[model samples]
Target: MATVVFVHAHPDDEASQTSGSMARAASEGHRVVLVVATNGDHGDVPDDLADGETVVHRRRAEAAASNAVIGTHHVAWLDYADSGMTGWAQNDHELSFTRADTEEAAQKLAAILREEGADVVVGYDWHGGYGHPDHVKVHAVTKRAAEIAGTRRYLESSMNRSAMIRSHQAAVAAGLDVGDWDPSAPMDDGNPLGSPEEELHWACDVSEFLEVKRSALKAHASQSDARGMLEMPEEWFAQGFSWEHYIEPGRPDGMVTGWFLGEETVG
Candidate 1:
């Protein structure tokens, strides 16, 4: 069985971006490891909390629930504080993941890759799908980690920009209230979201895993603030999230249309 390690920026990111690929890998008996870069300390605040409970506690529990649902075999954390958004005050925080030394963070992840003998290390795309500060840091750190660990394949979890545009249009036609966010427009970092479809190397179909994906996202209950994705009805959710996209480091074209791994069914 191959070992695939997915390195993500925050607690809920794995659930949204690469959860399907990770779950599919694990279901195929490939060792799947998730390395979360931060505690998500600055994420959406959940209203209902025990007297002293913090978002950290809530998020950790949520992440654990997601880990179980995704069938991930191992989980690790860099324990850095979340770097909020592009220009938030937290961007300059000393403990923020964005402020972390790229090499130093890469060393930590590289150790895990070496320990797990990861055959594939998955990172984020160049602009991190919306250009969040910590996500960009994840891209940087994961790239260096793959190099340091000498991992053979480095697949970047990416969005198919063209596909997303079509999907958004479809959602609108279906009368789904997807909000005013125009994904095609420039993001906080002044770069457009995701890569053009032609630039994507794979579109891993996780439709069958839709239920699992929804369950995993639900695990991050504290993220109720972002209700658009979380509150979507069943059919709408399926329509919007049936496929998870990716890019192979050197390869620039072709779509997988199925699992990231080969179609050999597992027992």
Candidate 2:
């Protein structure tokens, strides 16, 4: 079976973006490896930490639980500190993933790709979905790593912006209490959320694994970000996350419905 490695910026990212793909890969008997660039030290601090336990430690534990829930065969951490959003002071931290040397980090991830013999590698979109500094760094680092390892199939994990807008409008029309967040609104680095519809290339239907994804999200219960998602009902979660989106750089824009190591068709 071919190996597929997913490179993510922080803990819990797999749950939000690529857990479905990972699950699909494992279910189909392909090896799935997840490499997280940072320990997520900058996420919302939970008040329930045990004495002397740090956020990094808790996040790592959560990641481990998430890995189990998603059936990931293995996981590796780059262990860099989280570089908080666009302008946060943590971005300047010496050990922050965002500030790490690109080549150095790429070399590290390349080693993993080489060791895993990855047939496909997945990273973040150009602006990292919402332009978070660490996420942007992940995109660059993973791209270079794939090049260094000579892996030709590299996909960028992203959201379908037009789909998000449609979902938002549907919620509104149904008198649902939609939050203020808008797909077209300026986010992290002043970029609108997700890649536009025409820019996307693949859509992996993970509706069957919605329960698995939700369980993975719940594994990260300590974080406020995950807590919000956990609060979402199963139907709402399915409505929003049933299909995970991706982009194969330099490929044509038609959306393909398929998994990591399977036949695909333009939809």
Candidate 3:
């Protein structure tokens, strides 16, 4: 069995993006490690968290609980903070992940890869899975770290350019707000706000992991709202949904999919 490391920008990202793959890998007897880059303190703050420290602690607990459901380990805060959404005006926060030194972040991720002897490293696509600054940083650092660690790197994207239009059209035809969104906007380019099929790299059938994903998502109660629920279809929730699609970076040419055993490294 090989070791796989998933580097993410925040707490809920694993659940929202790749929990199914992680769970699948673990169940298959491969070691899976989740390296979250931020403290996720910027996530929805509860009214009860009058103390900033308390908020961080609470979010950490929530993250831990969420990871438990998937049977994976969690790590975080190597040195950056969540960079919130783009153009949110708060993007320039002093502690934002965007501002973190790239080398520093890369080194932290490299350490995890080395320690875990990771055979494969997974991160976000160029758009950072929705273009969140932190997610973008995670992608950048994961690429660098995989090189530093001498491991294969995978980029997780939602859909390809073609599929994006198709999914959007379908959603729009279904009366969803597909047109009201613009992923190409400077602040929103990374996050298209709706499903785009072209963005997908390799779709994993995670129908079984959907409940686990929902449970983990629900763990962050402050962040879970009606809109978030509406964003997901009840059928998807019930029948399970495809959770992750990944793009392998450094491949010579053409698209490839499946569990990477790190054969490329054995020169």
lDDT of each: 0.86, 0.89, 0.67
| lDDT at position 159, candidate 3 | 40
1-267 per-residue lDDT for model 1 (tens digits): 788899999998889888888888888789999999999999888889899999999999999999999999988999999999999999999999999999999999999999999888899988788899998898999999999999988888888889778878887998988788566899979998988988788888888788788889988877964354778777767866788998886764576676667745221
Model 2, 1-267: lDDT tens digits are 778899999899999888888898889888999999999988878889999999999999999999999999999999899999888899899999999999999999999999998888999999999999999999999999999999869999999999989988888899998778788899999999989888888887998888888899999998878889878886888888899999998777688776646745211
The order of the candidates by lDDT, greatest first, is 2, 1, 3
Model 2 off-target regions past 4 Å? 263-267
Model 1 misplaced stretches (Cα beyond 4 Å): 170-178, 225-227, 263-267
| Regions of candidate 3 where Cα sits further than 4 Å from its true position | 50-53, 160-164, 174-187, 190-201, 225-227, 236-240, 252-267
lDDT of 1: 0.86
For model 3, residues 1-267, the per-residue Cα lDDT tens digits are: 777888878777777677787877777777888888887766777777654456568777777887888878545446466677777655788777888888887988898888888877887777675567777787788888888878755555444444445555676789876545444433456345323443344555666677777777777666654228536668635433454566665455443454443344321
TM-score of 3: 0.81
Q: Estimate each model's TM-score.
A: 0.93, 0.95, 0.81
Q: Which numbered prediction scores highest in TM-score against the true structure?
A: 2
Q: Name the better of 1 and 2 by TM-score.
A: 2
Clashes in each model (backbone N, CA, C under 3 Å)? 0, 0, 20
